[model samples]
Target: MTSKPLISVIVAVYNGSKTLQRCIDSVSDQTYPDKELIIIDGGSTDGTVDLLIANNDKITYWQSEPDNGIYNAWNKALNHAKGDWIYFLGSDDYLWKRSVFEETSSHLFKAESENIRLVYGQVARVTKNDDICCIEGDSWDYTRRGIVADGICTFTHQGMFHHRSLFETYGKFDESFRIAGDYELLIRAFKEGGAALFINGLIVAGMQTGGVTANCTKLVKETARARRNNQLRVITIPWLISYAWAICYPSLKSLIGDKNSRYLVNSGKCFVAVLSYKKNAILEHNNN
Candidate 1:
């Protein structure tokens, strides 16, 4: 008898017909065979569904319909993933190397079966123009230190593999957050989910240099929101709300200038140290 693919790959697409072809091709080129690939479309009117249909046989299953939002789309995709391990690759991104699947699965099997919850690899940034910026030595080796710290993010929905139940433990992504939902979901994963490993190779993501995040103003605002999430459980909920309001108080001159910066500066220093060192930071993440 033959064995099945160890990972189930999901590609989430919505009006991504422009780049969906490259994304699908990357997954098909994966050296590891026997994996199932699922594409979930959120009712694209721009021929995205047609592109997915042209290669229908390669996809395990795909459908187009109205949905709540991106995170909700991801939750729906998770339901269709049936492999021993699951990886969610966005339609706008492609895998870096053909060996990515094999490399990620290598770590998955290396850990004790009971200890394997998820495996995340590094990511290469491909720009909006499709220019690739491969950054080596950025793996961060999530398993050893974990990936829940501030300023630390796990990329490559393409290469982040996990056991099916990892999602169950943390629950689904919070739909309330419009911009920081993925960050919130990953925070949930590393904080509450079980064991995980990080591979030291580049996986795949178009790290568009001029993307929304690159714009300094947007980055600053989102950084502040992420900072609030970082402090969510450490302080009382009411206090946290006050702290968040303080951080968001751009209307006041002291908020933007260094006049009232001492509290924030000191708080950020503590956030970095405490976030990186916790043995199982997830337990502390939701205490509030």
Candidate 2:
């Protein structure tokens, strides 16, 4: 790859007229010159097509057609992407800063040297009330050990940058998965010993507290399927338990205040810790 390889930023949308412009503007205003914006719209009828038409000059390539789901849209974006690195963003999300790609160029080159196919950074989450919360990249481990043991996704899609070759090697996102496809893709890459690097800076601002993953039941179920498909049965047990807990959590929060609900949740954690400690102590005594 060239020292300044072209970075392709892909945004997948569906009736996102409200937030589409902001997403386009964020990419258009990037300090990095060697970058292209590609948009894959899922046949939006909410004036989103008109907005894209208005800003056609800014986009490298764009298309509007009905797709199965977000992952399918992303796969279409991948087919059109012509950059050395590809970054996916939702129409509701935007680059966190104009210099995000500029600032991360050196790290990207370093990753290339080390044969790392994935790089991700921090993300600023914009809540429903417009409050911004910075989520750090190192907030959780994305290493193979961490993924297999925990069966959880540590990185957010908006902040992740993928070497275009990753798709060719590991295969495209499974369109069959309505949700959790990103998680499943990462699990496959990690399991295949793909190297990933983390950059400690904000890359994108994600509109949070919504989306398909917001449906807790569906999220849990899809996540379980992803884990099972990846042969992560050890983590499946805890995942199922967590799914049941999630189902009851909303009712508990509604009955109790947020503060009391949190306290109750912490109490359960404490109980688990006590049991774990006792079990370890018993095992040590028996070994002695």
Best TM-score goes to which candidate?
2
What are the runs in model 1 whose C-alpha is more than 4 Å off?
Answer: 1-5, 112-114, 134-156, 192-195, 202-288
Q: Model 1 misses residue 48 by how many Å?
A: 1.1
Query: Would you list the clashing residue pairs of candidate 2?
Result: none
What is the lDDT, from 0 to 100, of the residue 86 in candidate 2?
Answer: 90
**Model 1 — TM-score against the truth?**
0.69
Q: Residue by residue across 1-288, what tens digits does model 2's lDDT show?
A: 777978999888999998899889989998999999999999999999999999999999999999899999889888889988999888888887888888888878888988888878877556545565345345223333335445444456888889988898889998889988988888887774556777765545554546675565676678778878888763543354556655876787679844454345434433443444456568879999
Q: Which candidate is the best by lDDT?
A: 2
- The positional error of residue 6 in candidate 1, measured at the CA in angstroms, is 2.4
> What would the per-residue lDDT of candidate 1 be over residues 2-81, giving only the tens digit for each residue?
23336787776778888889888888888889688888888999999889889887889888998776677777878887
lDDT of each: 0.59, 0.74
Kindly report which residue pairs in candidate 1 clash with one another.
Answer: 5-34, 125-207, 126-206, 126-207, 191-282
